[model samples]
Target chain A: MNYTSIECASSTSEQFVPMSPAKTLKVYWLETKFEWLKTIRNPAFALPAILFPVIFYLFFGVLMNHGNVQAASYLLSTYGTFGVMGPALFSFGAALAVERGKGWLDIKEASPMPASAQIISRLIVSMIFSLLIIISLGIIGVFFGGVELSVFQGALLSVILVFGGLPFCLLGLALGMMLKAESAPAIVNVIYLPMAFLSGLWIPITMLPNFLQTFANFLPPYHLSQLALKVMQQDVGDSVFTHLLALTLFAVIFFVFALVAHKRKQN
Target chain B: MQQVNSVKHSDASQVVASIQGLNKSFSNKQALCDVELQIKSNQVLAILGSNGAGKTTLINTLLGRLKIDSGEISIFSSQPGSLAVKQQTGAMLQVASLPETLKIREHIQLFQSYYPNPMDYQKVIAYAGLESLQERFSKKLSGGEKQRLLFALSICGNPKLLFLDEPSVGMDLSARQSLWKAIRDLKNQGTAIVLTTHYLEEADSLADEIVLLKQGAIIQRGTNEQIKACVSSTTIRFTTPSYPIDFNSVAYLISHDVSGKYTAIQTNELNQTLISLLTKYPELEDLSVSRAGLEEAFLELNKDQLAQSKTGKSVINKGEAA
Candidate 1:
């Protein structure tokens, strides 16, 4: 209860000037990567996103050969799309909601870090998990089903699909920014299952009802799977270019919407 | 009167953040109205208010996390949430939820890399009193411990200005005192602090300036001495002897309470009343006269609003609900 206004006055001499945006982003990137490493280090969060798809693929592709069609090749592509979507939606969207609920988003916004870095890092982290799932699914497809593809083909497919999945990952981020953590699982599931089902990831869009076929084409996942299907055959189609453009457009729209929403909620 | 127009000052030393006529709303609800605030360098500006008093809204606006309906905000002479301004600012918001999966130390380390020269991990750990809790995952820590770890993370960046909203919400008294000391230490290092708290005592004891906000407008702003002048009455508490003093005899007496062996009186005339009390009740023991606490001052400032709210017609209360 002693008054020390004099001391308080003298202390304001030293000021901290902020770093440039690029420097701030660089720092944020390393921090986010480290954060991703921390999350993946835990068996609980890391194990499920990585292992669930692998296990599901094994059960459906190898163990249960219910149909006349060779399940290996068919399930490989379908499950690969499923695998990528798992991390993009489950980890990115769900984690976004949970983090927002906890007020971590506020903390990040209040920091010296670049705003774009926060979203980009989370997207990158999600993609990393997606990449792992793709690799696991691809290996299983090769070893079990006798699917013959050169390393170049396999590597090329991985690159294309990973990049193709970016739009979905961004879409999940937008959902996370908009929805509450408790409601995230439900909301994400609403979008996730439909895209997975109607987009030819589980069953080909051609086999679906005429209505769903048209609906699936509008979704990024349909374009993604179509691109993946063509790439696995060592070919790129007109659909690939169209899908990439559509996905990029979707990413931009969602990205801006999420940023604005986040900014609004924060203030 | 030496007028300090908290808004016009441009020198870094004069102000850490300068806000002018800020207005905000949520759908149809007006959350803030003509809110102007000035947070000077190295001073602890405690924003005191009840729940939904636009404390969070004001903080968010300063951080540029939320867009204002109308106003000008300058943090370190840059816009709020600007990278340059943010680099100088560190905040421990009421809503901060740590990533549960990460250990305390790793979180600290990760945040440290975001700043060019963050405080040493050991120092932040020691200051926040989180040495033992550093290895614990954020989710594993208790509420109080989580607050400490977050407090650690906030200071790790060595920010020039720090914002803490309800910083001691989950802390024990001892921890609260220690945290206040740490805040003072930070102030000594030239870090300006703008803290929001419902605990009036914390503000009374720690703040260099206290700005009490009600319905988004500042009801009162001043140092403790300046605020203490707002108290129109003095309080006198004492143990009375067998002779019971009649309340009617004391002209300045505003109110009196008798409980067991003690009698307390609140009065307006301090000197004349004390003289009269000595003459009338020489046996009065343990006598004490003191100015009003922040709680009393706050209640006085807020009495009209509280009364209106009691009548179920408070504008701010209604706005908050909407």
Candidate 2:
């Protein structure tokens, strides 16, 4: 069959013909902003992600433990970790699973944007949600719980909680890749609620049974909480290196599983 | 607007996409066999098949969503899914679902940003007849509305090549007609299209070329008329006034449905059979020739194997013959 390629060269006039890094960056920014918008607008994710930790803190750290300075500082650090963890896991973990199940991921794969742009956007949005949670908790802590910290300590704690969401994001990725969309929310809750409590994010591990405290030594959130607590001079557990190593190990493990499952799905 | 990377070629036939020796499998079931196809610019190639017939796999491979086990595929002279090809290509996949939280306009704008050069968002909305639903959340739209939105997103990139997998699956009659008009407009503007659908009339109306896939292989490929004619035989019907049409004397006679008033005869060598019949029965009256419909041709061509796979999940005549 003879085919005439008339006007084939007209493709030259397209704006981003070469797809420069600048344009790629623009794609990342666009995806991130849209994702952030979707996150904030979704009551299923927004109400719980933004409000739950603050509400929980007001009830437990501020009201129940009113005028208890030590408990206020400890619970403030732990609740911040708990708060940051919800959005990270729900957004990356449950959202990705649902997106994958709905075939949205496939549509994304077929688009002109780079694959890394999708991940980068999700990561940035996760960080932003974590920041909002940390800031919200900080205000509630300073005013109501009377939890005090220097500027340096506050900055360090903010940094830890914001970035500390990474391991959970990786965990969510693995779960998203491995589990069904319907199962993701239930499974995340299963892992999240228990891990938070077991790791002493709800109550200090020191106050828990000795065996439970020993068990906290192995959990990622325990390390994250301890690092957050260190910001207020309230470190009750492992050395900073141990916490960092444990978190790093979880991140690596989750990352590997996510990569493997993702590859398997595509193949 | 994103400009795809340019690659010079000796042949200027504007091959929008091509695949050679393509093969893929899932576990023990082969999803795609050794398939080779070429698509030129401004052409619409309709892939026709039932469920599990490798239609989805072929579309997925072309879009670079699934890795080909072994084969060579290219779009615009670049590897499939390469940035250059991606900039110029668009797809509405069979399994795709849009985010419910986004409004119609947001979805279109977000997808348009992915491309370097895109049609104006308003033009896309106008083309898709999505003007009224622009500000409405996607979750509020009906099924047909969602399909239209997806179609709009696919074309918003000003893509040179578009893949629409059952693009009208959930559309109402009016919406489907409007979608067809939008697709025809794109084709008129020189966009090459690859469409897969269960609707035979869709292919008859839009496809410049048609490929009939059965069990991961192309059983037939041609223009609409050519495929309709290529079903291996046609049935000639006539009512004889005096002399009877003799079936034994005619060549390529496969069978006959003879009645006292009228008769229908099947023959592969339709011309020869007609010539013989005319010679034998000069008084034959009320004569007519009818070729099989594309749907019947499809079913008959793959009747044997399709009868065997026998799974009833997809659109079908399942387990009937098995």
Candidate 3:
């Protein structure tokens, strides 16, 4: 109950001013940096996104398969894409759902920062996770898989999967916006794990039942895996452009769904 | 003659924010009914109400989180959600939270990036009393500590207009004093603040203007003195000596309850009534006087509303308060 307005008045003499509103680029960069720290530090994103793919590769490609270089190289692309998908989906879908549920999203809505900064920040974090997954898998491929590939091919595949992570992120975002926080992880898992298996990240599509193999062509991961395989000169069932087009279409569809869900929430 | 219009008394040169005939509803039950408010720079306006009194709704409406069904709101001459307004405004919402893993300093820094002209971290920490907890993770802090960190984030933007919904609800007495001090400094710096609290004494000490809300309506709005003046009656309670004192014979007595051993009297004339009471019953023991405090005024205004609310379920359309 101290009414010391006089002391505060004297203390308020400093010409303290807020800086100009942050530019869009600065907002994106800062948001990414903090968001990256958040994503990397969270056991939810880090343990599964980085460790799962690396562990899987060690088991199936190294110890189980006895270091078959060609098989190892082929599995690397699919598993890298698989690793990338987990973070992209969970970060946007599950993390966003929880943030929204916790009322953090409402706080940002009142902030001066650009709305798209949230979306872009999540994307950047997911891509960073994708890079980590690819690199971790690459190191594992070299040391354990006895895989040998040119630097250009490895970098190209990494870039491909990194970009390929987006569609799953969009899918996660749509799920996040539509579902409750408690339901998000369950829903993302239902979509993520099944999609990874159906799209042949665990096994080649040709080895599956004919109908399942045919169905794999429709899934974005299948296209992503196909493109990565094509980069390694593996015999993909479809043309490179077909896989690219399929992935692009998936991105567009999921992106639209996420956009619509966001708009709906705003209203 | 007294000038009765609250809006007429507001300084024309210093309107920091205004709401014109704001009306909002959820489904059929109207949550806000034709609410009008004008806030001036450097003034602290407390929105006082009990639970479910639309305090959070008004805050959310001003912050542009909930769309008002009707009426226009302007902050610094711009729309509530517009960039011009948002840049000049900061809010610590009732149910808002921070990222748990981030350290206190990290939380401040993140919110700092949102504003064009944010105060330095040193000023923010000093004012918010967050210096000691700077390195602590947000998840590890006590509820009061978390609230202080949120306050720091709100002020770090150097906002010209600030909205705090029950800012010190969970804080200890010392922490509460620190928060009030920070708020006072911000006010001294010419920040316009809108405060909502159930603590009547908080409103009594800090508010330049108080809006008493009931059932989504502005039942009373004015300065501290003006509000107190609205309820002119005072009460005198005393234990009687079982003597039949004709309380009605006392002039200025509005009403009196005379029982076997007690008498309670209400009147507008305090000094005259006290003199008359002493002359009539010098033996009157345990005498005490009570003025119509803000809590009484609030209860008086919302007596019917409370009765109606308790009889049945209040429509729960405004679920955002959770």
Candidate 4:
């Protein structure tokens, strides 16, 4: 296609000019950058997402555990899972609901911005926040709690917990699409806190009642925390493949819910 | 007026977009019924209507945001909302907002990245008159300033076709004037604009063609003057020391309103009404005669439609009735 001629053309033409790969990448990059900037500047999201897990880890993993390496290591893995979930859920769930209510999403829909750019940007920002949360928890766990871990274990745990946020991001996306802006934060909290506790993110699953531990088998966060614990050799006697399969199934289910909610909204 | 004429004369042959037999309904209520419209390059097409008249629906359908029940919409020779069409189209929809934490410059830059070809950053800023407020976070800006930023974002793509839905709703007088100036500049540069506004004066001053929609139908479509001519009435204003008791009985008088200093009378038969008024009260002073404005024409057209529907009679064009 003659780009200049198309620009100058007065009449409508049938030709479709695809955007270049570099420009497409630039769009995604800019979208992700601004999403990160917006969320970081929001004290409401930034403060809780970074601080809550660190505070919880200091009190539970360090102060309360009394320098027990076993307990500290166990809490570190679970707290890491807990920390990453905050950003993924709140950023996607609450922020998306608020934006949708404000009609900002409509403007984006009407624009040439690819729909995937919006989703991908939020996903990327959630992962970035996940990384921050893991590192913060790691610092508290190592410096204060006397937990010992090799570099390989630390890196593997961080990677697992950080990426494990994907299913939760999808879940948040579903909630954001389904809930009203006014109730999104409270509702996400209603879901987030209880799910975290039941999944053994706050305490080890073995400590929970037997029925509750059985119930944890059905929750995505439980699988995620188990995967993170597997990195530290502290998880229950389940195959890694079982946990992986469970998380994958949960991701597919959440994605399907998000897709359905999105379609319902469009109609 | 000269700009409108020049726009019509220069690039009127190019149809940037068009809709044929468009129909849309929301469940049971018809939102748009067999609508047809042609948007030409360099011309401002004003979709004038009151609330619930399907102006938004038509724009949404053209933007490919809503699917029409049975119709064809072609923009840039492609389906509405297609990437090719979106690449060349810019829209500032009503009641839309921006993320509060992003600075004006960042917002513009991000929106610019969405298009294959975008306007220069400085040019977009200048167009929106945000030279000094580039660093200001959107949360800190006033309502008008936020609207200006939204306008800037819409034009970031340097679109060939632009849709402005009630663009000046919250803008102050000066902000509105600047926006009008920017719109004119874009039109002069050959951008086709679809403006939906209830501000009849805005439509009057900016539109090369006015389309009046009522209850999901086009009641009238013509030039500003032609639409005004539909009412076929002239307004006469004069001040009298004592109010005339029987002014309502004047020949051919359509309506009358008395304010503090002047009593304005609208009549289809201008000469006859003036003669009768003058003969009855020779003291009438400060007399002035002017054609009915677009607002009066719009009200008259809508009123005629309401009367027709009420009476179970086919809608008769008031222009032809006159």
Candidate 5:
């Protein structure tokens, strides 16, 4: 509408300066911060994510076990695995699918936000949820179930369970890219509940039938729960390297699936 | 001559982005065909077409969301999706939402972090008219308010080039007016803008140039006045008189329609047609003569395309309508 003003304004803002390292870091930081804030504020997601495993453990590990330390400690490892999987799976899988369907993902992609920031932010949130779940379960196990553990063993178990959620995160990422928004929650639940049961996260592999016990080897959550059990010396006597290798293999497979889905979406 | 002079004056530096012979297809359906476009600084180019006319497809290709099959797309002399191009570009796409939990100010703050040199916080809020609603969560906002928030995010970077696709779709009149004012301010700030809208009046008021697309091909390209001039015929409407006059003798008459009490005549030669009608009936009441607006011109152009298709004719002679 105004020609002179346009000519004047165009002259001043033409350069495309590169971002500084500090500014780039700030972008990642702020992205993660906002992502964390959004997730925590949603009661539907945060409430179930933090409370489910804690409640399940309090019921099965304490009230039913009647102060049996060995059962409490073993259930702690399994329930911790169960706890971490919820956040890692739903955050990456369901949230991502909704974002994609809403065109929110497209908006972010069109901006200068680094794609890695998105993935990294969700990973951090999942781990934070895992930490909260493990701590709550830990408090219940110590005070109610009388499970005994040195500080070192407790810390190692926490570290294993928190980091072991990586494979599930990758699996969720792959599903998120593939699933539609309206059906994402339903589909994710279908996959999650069965996988958790099959992996012996709800009950120990030894308690299952021979055929089902053998099937646990193929599920990523089984390997993660087994790794957590190793800290309590209650694992099925496999070397630590075996479980780690299995989780790594699953992560690699899921990562490839995620990559293929992402590439397919771009075209 | 004026277009040529404007082109020569702007030179290569003013051309922010260019698409040459672009072609894209989805399976058996072609989404774009041999498209060529140039986005110049300080200008608004409106792409107008009906649904499935490839407007969104073209915008997606420019945003690098869809890959073109054959063509050259250079934005800031780099590839479309490159960080360098994205840094200098902003877009307000047709989206269903922002993250529902985040407040407006939080969304703005997060988006601002994406760009290296972001606009000031207060300035972006003022430009998008989000001052009063800054504290509200995104999910609580109405459709128009959400559109405003999306607009704010798009301009958070103070981008040199902006792509707005149906930006005013759900906006109220006052909100739409403010959006237009903000667009004008951005244009004055030298932002090269590409707008696609169904509202012809919106395009007419904001666009320095308009591209009419049909069935994935550009049918016409010109300024508002130039495009309107393509229709040529003006309409003359008057109340029917008691005496029936022979209208066939009217010079340069395109058509005449008598509906109820009103007689409307369309002709290319406005002066001769009015004179002939007035001479026949000295007491012509409620007479009005008006040229075709952009909406009429657009429909006329599309009607011509339909006629051309039925007759097995081709009108792909680019820039001829101008």
Candidate 6:
């Protein structure tokens, strides 16, 4: 057909070059941040996660006070860790699973966006939501809750607690991508309530059964709570180092599985 | 933007995608077997198959969303799922389930930023017929509206290649027609399209080339005319009140569609068969003849697979592997 002859003499003729991997990832991150912003502005998506933490802080940290000042102060730290866990599990995890079920992940895959950006965006969004929860709870703990922690202590508590809670974030990410949406809320509840109770969110670990205390000591929530408590109390106990190591280990394992699961789903 | 110009303006005809000896197994079930295909630039290749015929699997392989047990697939001369190649492709998967809280316009804007130089925001909204629905939350949109929104997202990037996996599933007739028009326009703009649809008529109408898949394998690949010729012949339909006529009497007969007081004989010799049928069944009335369509060819292509499943030679079509 002599197809080349049509544009043979044209100086504008060019080859179809594709975008680089790094550029594609950059686009994905930008779009994802934009999505996070839109999600933030809607209030519908943001309200439940944000409100849940604030309400809990008001109720447990301020209203009830748990009778004992030290216990109330302890609850403040525990609840800060507990507060952000909601969005990490309910919002990010449930959303990931449901989106996968509905084939949205597949849609993104087909786009020119980088695959890593997809997961990275979700992680960043969840982390940001978690950070907000921590800061809000810390504020109530210092001001309204009548807790004696200083601004420096409260800020340090929030920072440690944010990263301390990463394992839970990765755990939620894995669970959300693995399970079905119908079972997501139920499954999240199953994970959430027991972990919170066992890890002493509702009760002090010292009051729990010896078996539960031992088991709770191994969980990520326990580590996060311990880290938050140490910073808020200005007491760096020997347990703090163990909790950090354990939480880091849990995050490493979880992150590996989540990446593997994502790759498996892709192919 | 400078990079965008350098990339998009390049020649795109040089075998942009190639699939060779692909094999995929999910646990115990083989979803794709020795599948081979190639897609060039500026061609709308329509993949036609019944539900669960590995259409999605093929797409997953091409996008490198699923790993194939044994196969080679490359996109734009690079490996499949390569960032360079994937970044140049836009896609509309089966159904979009974007966050319900995000408005349609927001969704469009978010996806647009993923490309260096996407189409204008107003143009995309207009293209997807979402001008009226742009303010509505994604959750509030009707099925057709959601489909349109998804379509709008798919083309906003001005991608060189587009993958539409059942893009018009929930669309209305007008929406479907408009989508087809949009698809044609994209093709005219030199975009390569790979689409899968349950609508055989849509395939016939829009596909420059058709690939029929069955049981994770390519059953037929050619233009509509060439594939239809696989079961080429005309169907002779007639009704008689006096007696029932057996189709065996006619030579060159392929099959029959029999109902109460009516029979349709599919034959290679349309002229001779019609004459024989009229003379033999003198009481015949309301006779009609028509060419075999993609539907008939599709049925013929899958008939053996269906029979094999029934006889327990193959797994049930709907059975999930453990």
When sorted by DockQ, best at the front, the candidate numbers are 4, 5, 2, 1, 6, 3
Which candidate tops lDDT?
5
TM per prediction: 0.84, 0.85, 0.84, 0.92, 0.90, 0.86
TM-score between model 3 and native: 0.84
lDDT of 4 by residue, B143-222 (tens): 88988988998999988899998888878999899999999999988888999997888999899989888888887888
With candidate 6 superimposed using the best TM-score fit, by how many Å does residue A190's alpha carbon deviate from the native?
Answer: 1.0
DockQ for model 2 equals 0.34
DockQ of candidate 6 is: 0.32
- In model 4, how large is the Cα lDDT of residue A228? 87
Location of the lowest summed lDDT over 10 successive residues in candidate 1 chain A: A1-10
- Model 5, B137-172: lDDT tens digits are 999999999999999999999887899999998899
- Tens-place lDDT per residue, model 6, A1-267, is 123322321221133345567766667677667658656866755897788768876887678865456766888888877876777776657777877788777677677665667666766777788888877876776677667887788778777766665777788888877888778777888998789888877677778898998788667887788777787552336476687788889999888887787766654
Candidates sorted on lDDT, descending: 5, 4, 2, 3, 1, 6
Say which prediction, candidate 4 or candidate 6, comes out ahead on TM-score. 4
Tens digits of per-residue lDDT, candidate 2, B129-196, equal: 99888999887888788888888888878888899999998899989898888888877666789999
As a TM-score, model 6 comes out at: 0.86
Lowest-sum lDDT 10-residue window in model 4 chain B: B313-322
Candidate 6 chain B — worst ten consecutive residues by lDDT sum? B313-322
For all candidates, the clash counts are 4, 5, 7, 0, 0, 12
Provide a comma-separated list of chain B TM-scores, one per candidate: 0.83, 0.77, 0.82, 0.90, 0.87, 0.87
Tens digit per residue, CA lDDT, model 6, B100-121: 7778887887778677668899
Check candidate 1 and list the clashing pairs: A266-B65, A266-B66, A267-B65, A267-B66
Best by TM-score: 4
Predicted candidate 5 versus true structure: per-residue lDDT over A140-239, tens digit per residue: 8988889887799889999999999999999999999999999999999999999989988878889999999898899998999989998889999888
Output the lDDT of residue A91, model 2: 88
Over A1-267, each residue of candidate 3 has an lDDT whose tens digit, in order, gives: 122222222122222234444455677888888898887677866887788999998898778887578889888988988998899888999889988887778778888778888989999888888898899999989877888878998889888889988888888888888878778888888988999999999887778899998888788889888888888788465788888888889889988988898776543
Give the poorly placed runs of model 5, Cα more than 4 Å off: A1-14, B1-13, B237-265, B269-287, B304-322
Clashing pairs in 2: A17-B3, B1-B116, B1-B117, B2-B116, B2-B117
